[model samples]
Target chain A: MVLHIMADALFISVAILTIGSAIVALETRELVYGAIGLAISMMGIAGFFLLLDSPFVAMFQITVYVGAVAVLVIFTVMLVRTQALFSIKEDPRRKTAGIVLLLVFIGGIGAVVLASGLGNPAFTKFNKPAIDVATIGKQMVTYYAPVLVLLGLTLAASVIGALALARREDIEQKNERVD
Target chain B: MATVPEEFRFGNFLASIIWVILIVIVLLTLVILPLTFIVLFYVPLPPVNGEVLTPYLFLTMIVDPTRTLPIVKYLIHTTPFKVIVFPGFVFAAIIAAATIFVERKFLAKMQLRVGPLYAGVWGVGEGILQLAADGLKVISKEILIPSGADKPIFWAAPIAFVATAAAVVALIPVAPGWVVSNTDVGLIAVFAILGFFPLIALLFSWASNSKYPFIGGLRALHQMIAFEIPFILSALSVVILAGSLNLTHIATSQHPFWFILFLPISAFVFFISSLAELERVPFDLPEAESEIVAGWLTETSGMIYGLIQLGSYLKVYALAALFVILFLGGWSGPQIFPHQLGPPDAIPLVKVLTLQGLYNAVTVNAIFWFLVKTIVIIMLMLLPRGISPRIRIDILLHTGWYKLIVLAFVNMFVALALIYAGVLGPGGSLSIH
Candidate 1:
């Protein structure tokens, strides 16, 4: 019982950290600060995944989210023309609407949670053990093979679209010069 | 006689003494943590019987049967026993200082010049003492927080980096079960802790608010992506062959046929990726010391920077051990002495110590091999640092996305085909299972 309580405490602590930092990330005026907060939140999420007994997911979270995405976000933020990003402002009404929508969505989720039974340990007790590399690979190749292909295709399409966008921008610039 | 550090001068003499004592306490914590295992685990076990007892000890007795390794293994397991000896940090500090001096001495000799003969005995001890002197010097030096630097992040980054290194030592299975936390997910934990390194490094770079660190961090992020895919994929191959991600299981799987032979490509990929992970030569482009003054370390100074250096070495040691456990059959060597020397049931303690000893000895023996592997790779890293010119950033990005990514994808397919073709298998079944 004590162990369960401690686990629950740690899980809640991680969730709070993740959500708190994520809010700071989304709401922060400073773009660099947002990236930093996002990285911190991602780290918290990774720790939460560890509690969930999914080390593979935790590693993926660290590698992709914290390591890659955060870095890229910072990189883009650095590249932007404005150095003092904190001084910038967005439309207040749009921000208020976003907050309202978020609260309503969360309220709906809360309502659903209250309506359902959740304290069931049996739901988590599967005979199958933790997912290792082989099982994941086997599943990825055999059952979810099409999804992998789709992801690859999506990546390719995005790259092609980006190239096309750049080409069109170059053409427009040339036309402007000609005019 | 000497003035105390400003941070140390909280109030008066007593407070200064307390501050000094606290630093010593922290140093002791770093050194003595490794030794607790030997005292707690190996000493109290019952003696071994005449029957060679366990398979692990049996194997140790078989491999290198010359020395009574099963008996005297504790002495060599001192890598982890680093905690017990208060002077361990001193030795580390000394060794690091000596490394610089020794390299200089070798260089001077090449140029037909004598090294620092006046400092100590043939300048041998000079390098050893230089580290302490340098420590004293660096500590006294003014710490510069650059104009545009993000103050808190700049200060916290080195601490975070060093903390991750400290955390790794807790999980590294030094000899047998002589580990702080022998979790089932030991291998994954190793990488998880390692993953913190780049984040802190990038943080340090960004916090400095410098152009170089920004570029370094950007390059490091890209390099990490390039190498991490292959690293994890190759690690997955080992997991597939071993049937477990547990370090113990991975080690034990090397019994009949080592995983290296079965999945040579995986081993190659893993080693190269590890080299890249540590941001060492060939892949040490983030620092490319010539191009950028130590990359992310450009602004760092004093003992904090030394801690980062120490952390890097710790990472090196951990990665080497992980490589050994995963590929080079861990602690499963032969016992030197027979149980007839001291009857079966009377010596369970002896047997345990001997096995532990053999485990340590084999690991120590393999440390030489491990060092050889690491050194060769380090030399390879240093070669590019010295010899090769830097590739353009665009070229680096292109190679990562166009070549390495495709190669990793192909390697995954290769791994799958190899698994299907029973390359990582023994006869019919998957070997580890």
Candidate 2:
């Protein structure tokens, strides 16, 4: 009984943290603070994954979202001049559009979730044995090989594309110097 | 040079001490005792020897010699004991402290100097107490924050660094069944925890709001992130061989032959990547004292610097232990520990004192070998600091991305070949039961 209460308390606190940090990420004036807020929100999501007993997913979530994505975001934000980071003017129309989009997203997600029967106690109780990492690896290779390959290709293409763009700028500057 | 206040009185000082003691006593009795009682009432007490131990019984058990052993054994197995005392913070901290002292002495010897000569009695102890003295000095010194700094992040970063390092420590297994957290995804979790260090470094440097720190922080980020790929890939070879991500399992899997012999290239990649990740000499651009004035750590002073050092050393221990577990045959040395400390018919007091109930010869041997291997790895890690010069940032990045990754992949293919050729892995001809 005590354990159950503790788990429930932990879940509620994590949920609150996730929502609060996400709100801060969207609403904060300073871009740096927003990045930090986004990182915190990602951590809270990892906490959710932990509570759901999928620690593998939790660790990957932390590795990808907080470690790579958020770091990149913060690095980019820092690259911009400090004066420009905090000097954004608030636009009413943009704010309204953001709120409407947020509501639509929430409604759409809620509708899909309700329709999918994911809220059923039987589905939520985790009666099935937890899938081990080896099984996941095997499935990734055998069943989801195409999807994995495509994802890798997409990432590689993006990286090459970025390099090409950067190289083009360098060449353009060099050409201008020659001219 | 310094003088006491004219109005300062010995009697007043003694009275103040007494008053403080009185306040502590009053608070303990009034606030702490009640709070403890309230918490105890709510907490479901575990059964001891087939009976639920109440608060009164627990107090009695503390003094009663006959019941004490069971209670002590039970406490030893508890999660809090594992996390805080034996296999967790205290153990890791002790190793980290020893590493610092050893590194100082080792580096000094390499550089032909007597290190820390004045900290111990008549220098007979060879400055064994230097770490203690340094800790005292660091604690006593006031923490200074630069003006216009981000106060919250500046304050929190060092602490977060230590906490994340400790989290990594918690995942490592020193001996069989001796770990704070024995999760199935321990290796991945370790990588996940490590990913936070670069972020913390960048945040701290940014928080300092200084030019040197900014440059250092960016270097740290680039170096750490760049090396992370090779680090992960190298460990992936070990994971493939072991067929399990559990650190303890990985350690135990190398009973026949160590992974280093099979995948020396991966081991090399792992070692180099770890050095980069650790920001040690040759890759210490993040805190290059000569060029960048201590890099990201330029603004850190007193306990802040102390905490960061502690965290980094803790990381050093963790990474060394990981290397031991992955490449070196972790805790797989010859049986040197005896079956029991004394004869079977020894005195009860002797048996109790020697912890016969808790003693396991295999565990002792495992822990002994693990520490020896870990220490050797740590010494190897420290060796480069004495001999090598820091590399340029571009060179470091190039090594991490181009050279190490290819090397790691080479060993990965080697591992795959070994697996397919019936040399390693499950049911392999070479795998001994």
Predicted structure with the largest TM-score when compared to the true one: 2
RMSD of 2: 3.6
lDDT of 2 by residue, A53-144 (tens): 89999999999999999999999988877675556788999989998998999999999999999988888676676778888999999999
**Cα error of candidate 2 at position A46, Å:** 1.6
lDDT of 1 at B355: 55
Full-model lDDT for every candidate = 0.66, 0.93
Indicate which candidate wins on lDDT: 2
DockQ value of candidate 1: 0.36
- Evaluate model 2: give its lDDT: 0.93
Model 2 clashing residue pairs (backbone): none
B11-35, model 1: which lDDT tens digit per residue? Answer: 6778878999999898778767546
Residue A145 of candidate 1: its Cα lDDT? 97
Give me the displacement of residue B211 in model 1, in angstroms. Answer: 3.3
Candidate 1, residues A67-150: lDDT per residue as tens digits? 667777877876786656556677899989998999999999988886775645776566676666557768999999999999
